[model samples]
Structure formats: structure tokens, C-alpha cells
Target: MLETRSLTVRFGGQAAVDGVTCAFHRGTLTAIVGPNGAGKTTYFNLISGQLRATAGDVFLSGARITTLPASRRARRGLGRAFQLTNLFPDLSVLENVRLAVQAQAGIGLDFLGLAARHTALHDRAMAVLERVNLASRAAVPAAALSHGDQRKLEVAILLAMQPRIFMFDEPTAGMSVDEVPVILDLIEAIRQDRDRTILLVEHKMDVVRRLADRVIVLHQGRLAADGAPEDVVASAVVQEAYLGVRAGDV
Candidate 1:
């Protein structure tokens, strides 16, 4: 559960996210959609502490975290996966996720201490890899995998962190038609968990339709429509802003 209160971000004379207030309920998957430059990602950055808000507040579970740094926010149960692939190309897939698991568990100091702890870490990482269907490729270097597999590795890393709230920025950004469904199915599996809250910034309408319990549409840095996917998609304002057509035309 997360809430934003009148969140605003401005760059010089332009407001990228303007006074947007919304709530993300527990166990719900919400999609944030809009055209280019709609401030969807900007809003994410603000809430995740990647970008400082010019005004307003961000709350996680009821506590205000507006001024918390990104790392602190992450430690407090916030997980983010960027649109771009970010991983150590040289590291094996298992190694990459093992590091995440170790970091989250604060096992860095004891990393070399007990063989048992090391084994535990490896088992946990391998479990996450298995969940993403990358267990077979655990020993391969991340760079050697296909682009879609690499994206799945990113999710695997986030899963290792075990955050209560997940923020995914364009999880299906670049992939072939066949690959998209695989990632979408993985996301759907995440949504099946009743204890996690997921917020996604996605462009694929089909993905949104299939996964989003609620849809929040943004236009020119402002809230355009917020409701069920079908209702929001059929809205006159959403159609005019995103489809460049009047409501009656639909």
C-alpha cells in the first residue's frame, strides 16, 4: 500500500507531474498509462526517490518517506526495475542474483565467514532463478543471454530482494512478439501473490487489460482518468488525449 498526496515535480517552467494524488492498494496491480511525455516515469522516480518532488509527499504503508533517499527507500521495502536492462554483463546469472540476495539480507560481512550462510544465499538465488525460468542458464554470463532472458534476469534480481512494493517501469519495453507473452506471464504470476503491491508503467494495452486491477491515465503531467481498464480506455478524455480522437468516434 502506497499513497501520494498532491505530488508535484517541475523543471524550470514546466511541471512534469502536477499535483497527482492516488492510492495503491495492497495486493493490487495498477497500470499507469499515457502517451509520450505523460510524466508516468517521472511520477515513479519521484515516489521511488530517484527524483525529488518539488512539492507534496510520498507515503509507503502510512509513513511519509518524501525525503528518504533511494537506497533508504529500497531498504524499506521498495523495489524498482528500470525499462533499460541493468545488470553486470560479466557476472553469471546466479552470481548477479546472489549478490542481490546477500545485500538484502545484509550478509556481506559474513559472506566469507560461514559456508552454511553462503550455501543458503546460493540456494535462495537459485530459487529465484528457477521462478523466472532461468535456472538452466544460471552459470551463463548475463550478456550471453538473449534480450528477453536478460529482462527476465532483472525481474529475478528484484524477486531476490523480496520487496513488499514493486515498481516496474516498462517491463516489456523491447521484445519480439513471442517474447512479450513470456514476460507478461511472469508478471501475471507476480500479481497472484496476495501480499504484494505492484505498480507498472506500461505501453502495451493488451498487457494492461490482462493484468491491471486499476488503470490510471495521465496526460501532459496530470491525471486524466483513473478507474477500471475498460472504463478508462473508453473515456472521452483518455481517447482525446491518447488516441487523438473524440469519444463518440469510438
Candidate 2:
């Protein structure tokens, strides 16, 4: 449902992503894996409209969105959750999600009513929180929640927007053993919904193996390997570049 055609991103004359071409299809979760500077995140920035590409094009459901701004992309059924938590620290969990719902509804003009006071908005926000398994923390200040909760809150905020394409950049960055299952389960549920194409940029091999239907391996800002997860995992280049050792050699 989303595609990047020979997409390249250059920063100050340094090409961070070079002629990278890939497509993310509906009903499938695609994982982008590579070395630290492999340009996975740069590719995401290009696709999400966070950073304009130096060349090539980005398309969403067949519509060219290369020049579209980030907000416009969000309005056009693209949802993104960053590696770091992006939330209103002082706002309650429910309020934070409500803000996204409000944005989706184009109700940012209303200010007199408390965000939590809108019953419909609150219900919708709660539903999103529930999807992330975070509904119980809805009344707490965002800053007071645990680190894992904060990550879930980020997912909830994106879920509130109800986008057709979800771009998650390191969704399970710093969670404890106890917290990992919760996050993984929530993501699994999202994948099972079969409603959107998910593009996940993650470092955790276990997470990627469990969640990705296909894998694309990048190395030195270029496409090095692209195929089923097992094939990519077993690839010689992928093993040397990102997987820490040669496959079957350890």
C-alpha cells in the first residue's frame, strides 16, 4: 500500500539513503533491518514526509506523496510512532490520546471544553488505549507512567488517528522482560487486524522475527537483501553486516 521508488536522501551532500526501492503491502508487516547507519530510519523519514528525499518518489496507495508535508501525510492515512515517546507530559493519558483524535476530527479549534469532557472523544481515546493495553492508566499524568506505558501510549496516540499505513520506528526500544510481552502482544493484535500495512524499524531480532512477514536488509545506505524473514536472516551479507556473525558459523 506504500512504496518508495529509487528513494534517496542526502544530508549536506552525504547520501544517507541511496536509490532504495521497496514496497510495503497491505495485510503484511514488513521489517527494515540493517546496521546502525544503514539508513533505515532515513528511509522512513523520507516516506513519512519528515524529511524530503533528495531524489525519487514516495507513493501511498498509488498517489504520489513525495512533496507532501508531514501533517498532510498524516491526514492522508499515514500514522507514525517515533523511537522516543512523543506525548504531552502534563496531560493525562486519555487527554493525550484525545488530542490526536481531535486532530483527526479537525476539532483543534475547540478550547473551552476540557478534552476529557467530550464523552465521544474520551470513549474513542479509551478504545485506543485499550488496544494498546493501556486503558487502566488513562487517568494518570503521562509523566507518571512507567517507561513501557509511555511506549504503549505512543502506540495509542497513533491508533487514535486510525491511519491505513502505520510506520513504527523502534516500537520496543527499552522495555523490560516483563514489559516486552505486553508490547509484543499489542503489536501482534494490530497485525492480526489486517487493516493496514505496518513498516517496523527495529533492532531486536526476536521482535522482527516474530512480527515481520518479510524483511529488507540495508547496508551502507543501500538495499543489500530483501526477502522472507528466514532468507534474510540466513543471508551472508545480513549476517556479516547486522546479525553479528556468519550464519551456521557460530
Candidate 3:
């Protein structure tokens, strides 16, 4: 459903994301794993339009979207949740998600014609909030929520958009142990939908193992390994270079 052909980006003489050519199909969750600075996030930036690639192309479904800006790509069905929470601090949590639903439905911010749809939007936003366990905090300003809640809110917004392709960059990065399960479970549920595709950048091997149908490893800005999670995780190069462990140990 998505693909990157020779996708690359350079910072001066260093290639942050080398020529990476890969395709992702519907009904699969692919976990991107590598050590710090392996260009996992850089690769994501290239695909999500955060960083324009130095060369190559990004294709959504079948057409090239390399020239499209991030917002356009999003409108074309690419949903991204960054490592940092992206929110409107001044807006209430419900408003934030409501706006996302509004966008997905192609409604303008102008609420003049929104009377008939307001109830529907609110119901959809509340449903997403409830899914993320944030319904009780619906009226709280986004900035007032805790860090974990903020991350969950981001996920809620992503869910509201209902993008065809989901990209999560370290979704559980700063959450407490008690809060991690919610996001993971949510992702697992999304995985069950065969029409959708998911790309996750997670450091937790256990999480990758549990949720990913496939795993791809990046090393020094290049695609080093791609295969079933178990095979890639146990490969000699991944065990030695990426994980800093021997094959036997892994």
C-alpha cells in the first residue's frame, strides 16, 4: 500500500537515510528497529514529508507523492504520530480530536454549516477518546494533560483521522508502565483490520515481537535486514552490529 524507492536523505557528506527501497502492503504491521542513529526516525521523516529526501521517491498506494508536503500527504491518507506530542495546547482535548475528525470528513474550520454535523463529530471524537481512555478528560485543555495523557491524545487524534497508512514514531516513549498497555492494545486492534497498514518505530523488542508481522532493521542509514521478526532479530548482523550481542546470546 506504500513504498519508498531508493529513498535517501543527506546531511552534508553523511547520508542519514541511505538508498532504502521497500514496499509495505495492506494487512501487515512492520516494525522498524535499529540502534540509536540508525536512521529509523530519519527514514520516517523522509516518508512522512518532515524531511524531503535527497533522492528517490515516496509512493502512496501506487502514485508518487514525493513532491507533496506533509499536509497533502496526510490528506492522501498518511497518518503520523510523532515521538513528541503534537497538540493544540489551548484547545480542549475534545476540540483537538473533533478538529481531526473534521479534517477527515473534509469539513472546514468554519462552523457555520456544522450545526447538522456537530453531534456526529462530537460522538466520533468521544468514541476515540473513550477508546484511549481519555473520555473523562475530554474538556481539559490539551496542555493541562499529563505527558502520558498527551501522548494518548495524539493517538486519539490519529485514530480520528482514520488514515489508510499509520506511522507511529516511538509511540510509547515517555509513558509509564501502567499506561503502555492502552496504546499497545489499540495498535493490536488496528492490526486486525486487514485493509490498513501500520509502520511502527519501537525500541521494545517484546512489543515488536508481539505486534509486528515483519521487521526491518536499519544500520548506519541503510536497509540492513528485512524479514519475519524472528529471522531479522536473530540474524548474525542484527545480533552483532545492531543489538551488540552474539547470535547465541540473542
Best TM-score among the predictions, by candidate number: 3
Could you tell me the lDDT of residue 29 within candidate 3? Answer: 98
TM-scores of the candidates in the order shown: 0.92, 0.92, 0.94
Candidates 2 and 3, the one with greater lDDT: 3
Give the C-alpha miss distance for residue 245 in model 2, angstroms: 7.7
lDDT of 3: 0.92
Across 145-198, the per-residue lDDT of candidate 2 in tens digits comes to 999889989988988888899889898888788887877787787798887888
Worst 10 residues of 1 by lDDT: 241-250
The TM-score-based order of candidates, best leading, equals 3, 2, 1
Candidate 3 residues lying further than 4 Å off, grouped into runs, are 109-117, 245-250
Query: Tens digit of lDDT per residue, candidate 3, span 151-231?
Result: 999999999999999999999998999999999999999988899999999988999999999999998899999999999
Quality of model 2 by C-alpha lDDT: 0.88
CA lDDT of each prediction against the hidden true structure: 0.89, 0.88, 0.92
Across residues 1-250, which tens digit of lDDT does each residue of candidate 1 receive? 8999999999997999999999999999999988888999999999889999999999998999999999889888898888889899999999989988987887665535863457888999999999888999999999999998998899999889988898998987887787777778878888899999999998777888999999999888998899999999888887788766323334
| Cα displacement (Å) at residue 67, model 3 | 0.7
